[model samples]
Target: MPATHATEHSITVAAPPAVVYGLIADVAGWPAVFGPTVHVDVLEEADPERGGEQLLRIWATANGRVRAWTSRRVLDPAARTVLFRQTVPAAPVASMGGEWRVESTGDGTSRVVLLHDYRAVDDDPAAEELIARAVDRNSHAELAALKEAAEQGELRDELHFVFSDSETVAGDAGDVYAFLDRADLWPQRLPHVSRLDLTEDEPGVQHMDMDTRSPDGSVHNTTSIRVCFADRGLIVYKQLKVPVAMSGHTGRWEIEPLGDGTVRVTSWHTVTLDPEGVRTALGAEATPAEARALVRKALGTNSSTTLRHARRFAEEARARA
Candidate 1:
């Protein structure tokens, strides 16, 4: 018989059910919400937040070692719960599944429950314990962070947007992936980049800190965590630290090969505006219209640069192959 293990943890946060649910539903923000999570990549999005399936690539620390895995998840806002199972289980974990439940305890409060059920690799007791430790530690941190985020302010009504650009090149997807996957070498390859500090503490997972010169001639320093999905030809990144005007920022890079002997490289971004810091980031003369336009242009410019560079590099690499 396979050794099965179950673990559950709960916390009461002074926030509403919907508020708590939103924090749980936004998988991309897990790096900030959970202490152990280094990055989260959404392979496929769940649009409705309820009765919709979402596929995710998660990179987290287990017993001090970074681990990466993908999960198939379903969300149900009405029931205030989300369900997930590992689509590609990592080592020491044969199978794993879990759910998030948020129950309203009062007008301005909620009780959040996190549950997990799993069987270890080879049904070994040692593997089971390792998995349990990871789950327990992460679940607790996530719940507490969710509670804190909910009680912060009325952020649910903030503006969120995604911008993307793509370039078609006569190269293969492998070259494109190699270029983006290797960020430590970006400073030498990309001009706008002034400095870069990168670490792949875990394979396929990266912690990157870099400085870039914005269009306005101002240098901005940002810290982000990224996860690469080699199979899907995708890479996802979330900023753990950002400028004052942004509340959340997440990005994606995808390399696809077309039948016509051309490959397309695309970069995408989703960001939420921080209402309280807009004036400070932009000058006093900046209107809401101007702020939005500036943000879109800036983000689009950077992503467009990446796509173009990847195209050229990939084509050259493919030519030699």
Candidate 2:
């Protein structure tokens, strides 16, 4: 057996222990809450909120590299702890496991401790060092984000919103998926996209930078990391650099076949607003409600346009066939 290395990172959050625990337990929301997490898929779970065993597939950034892993977790609500072990660890990681503990510190505050233990393949020193660095960086980032989110309390709703738009395509699901997967052509295909640069360093993992022209003729540049599940017809993306009004943003494009040669394509968005950014971009008098509306319109308009174009492309292909 190889020697294992361990690390622990802790933070004091201005929130109740239960609140912090709840945030940690809700793994599905990690992409929006944690900067390193790009996407999470719940493979198996039984009421994760109440505490139980669950399985998850996660795609995240590790030391600037996109990595995917499957984890088995045991959630203990009574103890305010979550224990997880990666069943299929990524390369250089022979095995990885961790525990998330939330402890009450009184006065409506709590302490969050993230602990990790892992070993490198063959116990190679270089591999071990790399794993250590990644664990340290991700742990700190996740804890700080968790602290900020839990402390928001009632104000959380005002900052975060989830919305989606759907359209029925007259062609096959594959065609619609192809339209989204081939985003490199967006500059030529999508009117609002003035410029786009895309690279898939690793299969199914992409990094993109693009300039989009908004309704007011203003152009905003953004960058994102996308993970594609081709067989499942799902593509999840996280914006690394966002507009002035958004603190965090994640979204998905899903294609579902209707079994009769038609498909339903949807674009889903989850956003966390920056109040001061809202004012900066939309004038100081802009209220939170107004910010939500503005974001919804701007984002929805772009998404609806993509769906329409995808529909047209797919239908045209079918007619040509």
For each candidate in turn, give its C-alpha RMSD to the true structure in angstroms.
Answer: 4.8, 1.2
The lDDT for every candidate, in the order shown, is 0.81, 0.93
The residue pairs in collision within model 1 are: none
Worst 10 residues of 1 by lDDT: 152-161
lDDT of 1: 0.81
Error of 1 at 316 (Å): 3.7
Could you estimate the TM-score for every candidate?
Answer: 0.71, 0.97
Model 1: per-residue Cα lDDT over 1-321, one tens digit each: 777788889998887788788878888767645556767768899876346899998877677667888999998878988999998999989999988899988777899889999999898888877888888887877777677667765643345566788899898888899999999999998877888999977687788899998766889999887888798899988787888877677788988889898988888877666656677878766555566677788888887887788888999997788
Give me the displacement of residue 10 in model 1, in angstroms: 4.4
Where is model 1 more than 4 Å wrong at Cα? 1-57, 61-65, 70-79, 82-99, 106-109, 115-137, 144-157, 283-291, 318-321
**Model 2 Cα lDDT, one tens digit per residue, 71-180:** 99999999999999999999999999989999988788999999999999999999999999999999989998998899889988999999999999999888898999
Q: At residue 166, what lDDT does model 1 achieve?
A: 89
